[model samples]
Target chain A: MSSPSGVLATGSAGDTRPAPVVSIRGVSKRFATTGDDVVALTDVDLAVAPGEFVCLIGPSGCGKSTLLNLVGGLLPPTAGRVEIGGRPVTGPPSEVGMMFQKPVLLEWRTVRENVLLPVEARNGRKGAKAARGRADELLGRVGLGEFEERYPNELSGGMQQRAAICRMLIGDPDVLLLDEPFGALDELTRERLNLELAKIVSGTDKAALLVTHNIIEGVFLSDRVVVMSARPGRIVDVVDVPLPRPRCLEVVTTPEFTALVARVRELLELGHDDDGKDGDR
Target chain B: MTAPADQRHEVPAPAAPPPDTRVAWGERPSIWVRIPTWISLSGFILVLFALWYLLSSLELVSPFILPDPMDVVAELGNMANAIGTGGLLAEALGITVLESILAFAAAVVLGLGFGFLVAESDFGRIVLMPLLVAVNAAPKIVFAPIFIAALGFGISSKVALGAFIAFFPLLVDTAAGLASVDRDKATLFRSLRISRRKTFFKLQLPSALPFIFAGLKTASVLAVIGVVVGEFIGGGGGLGQQTKIAGDLLATDRVYAYGIVLAVFGYLFYAVVAYAERKIVFWQTPHGVQAGG
Candidate 1:
């Protein structure tokens, strides 16, 4: 699956004239503690083109999740700017959807109702019927058509996550931020969901930024994998996956996939060694 | 394996379990059990009547000290007749009911308003909570006399006393209910960026209903007691007035009859409040069962 010329097609160059869907310029986040200030992210400059799939991978406490939240406009940057669709993000954009590590489904609401929550919050009752129909279609796409009437508690962990994914799409947002969306599931479940998510994202025009600690997952799913360093996290390298499109589970067993995984693993270990040196200082 | 198979065939099969004759207890208990309950209650009444008859027949006690139960029953008959003559008993009962109802309404409105205000606003809670404690701690009987001195010996005094006595529970319970919303639920709303008004109405209020209703039940009973105590202190009419009249004339039988009427009124008032609580908080009843069962 390696590109002989060492470049993956990043859509046509002509289509890149429009401003990137999200642009982060020299952004840093610092949090005050009892006695010292903690730096989470530092001088992170990144841009996501329209319909791009980017995965941020790092160790625990590396602030990859913080970067995702910044782009979602859930937090204000202490030092830099984050723009979405060419507009500076002062607050959560109506066109940006977020899915947290947990499903965050309202326990009192059914699966279908949970999916419809965003639409109801944004549009009220006027668009409720259309929202319901869209929610049903999304649920079907996520392989949960028969479980729409069931409550979150009645669903398995994987199914609950699927419902949450449907909810994220219900608003028809242009940008989707996923914070370790499959990090809680077992190995088999996470693998199955990764395949399903690839298909789902490929079918939509939304630009997705996934935060994960899994190296294989980053290679298997993202168009470009952004490897980040430890605390005061900054992007260390951007590795473009040259694997062919329409990837399946079989792709993970190939020699090309193993080499990409090895490269990410070395970068992550290098991030850890750098952190070790900083701790000593 | 051959021996085991032969033994299985040799074993005598049990009879067909009597065609599973036993049936489940019906969805509800049978009428026969209910009939006996009624009959046993009537038997209790008969026993009381026989005791009354035996005591009166033997003249076992002084008439002034222990009026025969039959005499009280007869007084009740006369009381019914007095209802037609001047409608005295009915009028007193009407006034008592009216006073109780008015006091209950006033207590509920004021208590719920103050409770929610205190629960919702930190400043209001800090300032008003101490004042409420002071008011609740004072002897309500003192308020009864003061109410009479200020409002005069009329229905207003009784109503005031009832309202005063009933407000504390309503305030306490309503505040507790409002304060008891789950913090996790609040965080969920915050994460969603739900509006504050929507959070209060949809999440907090519905969750607080059971606690508020509990306070109402306690306040209703207190309201009845308040009215009776107020009447006992100074009142122109009601069962308390009749008690004073019977005491003055040394009509013990008539006094007992009034006491019985007061007991029935108290029971009825409590029952009505309980019934309303069940109706308004019906979701709690079924939801609790599903959670714990």
Candidate 2:
């Protein structure tokens, strides 16, 4: 089997990398309920290279989000360990920035203020003021420069998400974790944001792990797509997206992209069928 | 893409033209709305004064029963002179104001602390909330006599009554306000790995400010009532005591004067609370003004 282009790209740079930015080692999460233990994930091991765009795709209740939270140190693994930059996952690391499915903008603050929240929370006024220029720059990059003074309620769904993305990037984190950040948008808007996200990820040095259910979006935006099984989720397949660099909407219509989407879809279908038998386990 | 004037005319006109033109034409009358509102308000006051004056003049109302407005005004003037010369009315008002202020401060601090505690912990909520509801449901007026008997007829008794009356609203409103935080926002904070204390300050407190102020507004009015009740039940120096003296002497005009002073005092307390609510929660100013008028 051919190695992933992402690995090859790093290999061709003439430096054999020593360690991945994030590594999940035999991680499993089980939640306790009345008289039963609900296994959410089981023996999930994955590694993401530095600056790589990795996408996790699975059906609902498949523990994709659980895994994302585990990697982010929001939740501890029940069985194994999750590490970031060679550090054992403890609490939230300032080096890792996170964004949720919703915009999660503080309604009381303006757009500019919302984008500067992490900077203010992690740092003080001096850091926030220093980050302000960068916040405005990101907003302009995301086409929201004119809306800095507007409240979150006044902005449309897509604009709010754009602001959220700017917020995620404002802290200048080395790693970005997005849990279905565009899952709430319409199909048209999601496709548009997929392209925007691809451009943003390519432009930054941050390693991003995106959890999504959209197969096409997974193929279009990721360097490597990790397909997950249903509840008690584990990696079923890891497909390398061979699409060329600087992808756009037109890439979705290509045969190579469609074949990759089909392969991921097959893995998900098989995972779903296996999940049916494992329901009682 | 401009249509000819003839074709524009051919397009049927709306049954009612848009109000833009009418609003501009009738701008003068819109300004007059405030004048009529003020006039109607003053007119109602004038009607009340007229009835009082006419009934008292015609002897249909006994002077000992309902004194004339003129008589009340004259009494008020005389009392103002007496207040200038170290009379009970001014001294009583000063004592009442001091008592109410102390009680209000204590109520706010204690109520906020307890509210936050009950809201943050499940055990506190389960253990204390039911007991609090029982205490709140009890007739707090009974506590006035009990407090006067226990604490004696001094500033402490009145302050205790006022604080007791004021505390319930602060507790209820604070709990309600903290509880009113959006669940989605809480989940967002959880995913961010924000600490519980930070979440309370950053998310819960601001969101609950409006409700807490609503409680305080209600409590201000209750605080005034509590002080007056304390004065009435216990024999202390306040407007209520002066009112009692006027009632015993059958000097109806002096009673009316004291009643007016009490009304003004209540209105001022309410106005101060309303003003504070406006300034502190300015984010809700637009909505408050719209709803108030």
Candidate 3:
């Protein structure tokens, strides 16, 4: 778990906060490949309190995505437990919304229809029909209301991804699990989205865990950046970002943000020197 | 010190995701590409008719063996009453159309049902699939006689034969389509905790529709073939049977006229399927030079 200091960010005098919205204890992930048991993640622990934005970063093939999957309840840990809102996660929970790297929008559905897909999938079309206003509101927030009726194929990659973001928020999930949500975008679009996501995160008390390769993005959006090591991945360090919110793209220019990025990079390199992969994950 | 120097340069973004392999799966091939091909096909057909016209006008060949194109057209015009009512050709066409429609509907329902069943169950694939493939591979024309012997020269025999013959393509194609769901999309559904039933209906089924419609386009033509052949073998007076009788009577113009009507009918069937496919998968359908989304 991260230090209680991080959780204290959400606390004030005379106000009680419950357990962290997301908790992982001794969690590990392994896949039985054809020839060998490939350990993707091993014995990693972490927690994210309500309203916090945590970013997980590491080298290629690190279990950053695996850990996100574990928290989303898409993958069961081979060893420990993943709990959300104090309950052990056995399968996908209603409160957890996930956004994959690709938009993964249904080609047949319109933007508005796609946004309400989870609601429709959980309840029937009538349930989704009732949430139409909410779906359009999300689309409007993402600057996609004009294109709500357009098919996914008709939209550009960036626009489709914006629709995907709207879909994730339409569910209004308590915990948002993002696997490189803006990783596929161009630099400017990614920076703009980081600022937008940070603003959205601040607006809602929903906790978000984002996995990304971009360290600048981590500094911009994260309250705490979880640095992980590769192979049978483990958390090498957690860097606290006391950066104030509604952080803008200008934060990347600050010495404090630059120092935090450098520090996380240093920890990642040091873990490589200390044989992170060679150790039991 | 180096970290400060490195930080002096802007932190680079990771490279953009590769453009999706458009060929992997997307809209139809463009109209710009299709138009010239259609013009060529029409030109080819026109050239063949012109050669036939030249041959007949020159008396270079026996008219009995190959009727003149003009004579066939004239014969078709003369048979307008027969084509409309009390005509053997009109009766034959009505029979063929009915049988094809029934066969097409049956094939789609059964083919999709069996295709999904086999794709979903390991046990079904292990046992039932091989048998289906064997039946599919067999010369389906051979079964026409058995159908006739069992159903005894009625339309039922033709319907049964048509249904069986058209069934295989839908079955095979539906199975192929269902199995073609993108891995990431499937994982997304699991993460959303969608019910298996919902997954099948909304995701697998819709995703499969494009491929399935492509199959349906093929099965539409096949269903026509099945019905005509069944009518030929089972002794009902469909276009197939009428054409055979016209051949026996050496009514070459009448035969060509029936052939013309049947060709138009087949084109209509194919066009209907193609049109339905366009509406259902409009996102992927090609327009001019490219299809997006």
Return the clash pairs for model 2, or none: none
Q: How accurately is candidate 3 docked according to DockQ?
A: 0.21
Better of 1 and 2 by DockQ: 2
Worst 10 residues of 1 chain B by lDDT: B1-10
**lDDT by residue (tens digit), candidate 2, B1-293:** 22222211111233554567756777555644657788888888899999999999999978999888898999889878877987767798778777877778778886787788788789769999888889889999888888998999988898899889888889889998999998657765665566778888888998899989998888887887788788888867987777888889998998889888788878898899899988777666532111000
**Ranked candidates, highest lDDT first:** 3, 2, 1
Q: What tens digits encode model 1's per-residue C-alpha lDDT throughout B30-54?
A: 5555577778788888998888778
Select the stronger candidate by TM-score from 1 and 2: 2
Kept native contacts, as fractions per model, are 0.03, 0.09, 0.33
**Model 3 segments more than 4 A misplaced:** A1-18, A272-281, B1-47, B59-65, B286-293
| lDDT (Cα, tens digit) per residue for candidate 1, span A30-132 | 8788978878898887777767789998877678878887887777899987888778888778778888778877666678988887777767667755678
* Two-chain DockQ for each candidate model: 0.06, 0.10, 0.21
Model 1 steric clash pairs = none
In candidate 1, position A55 carries an lDDT of 93
What's the residue-level lDDT of B213 in candidate 1?
86
Instruction: Give the DockQ ranking, best first.
Output: 3, 2, 1
Task: Give the interface RMSD of candidate 1.
Answer: 14.8
What lDDT score is found at residue B74 in candidate 2?
96
Q: Write the per-residue lDDT of candidate 3 for residues A46-147, one digit (tens) a residue.
A: 778789889998877678888888898888899987888777899998899989889999988888889999988778799999999998887776656677
Off by over 4 Å in 1: A1-19, A32-40, A55-65, A101-114, A143-163, A180-198, A211-221, A224-281, B1-104, B119-122, B129-195, B207-293
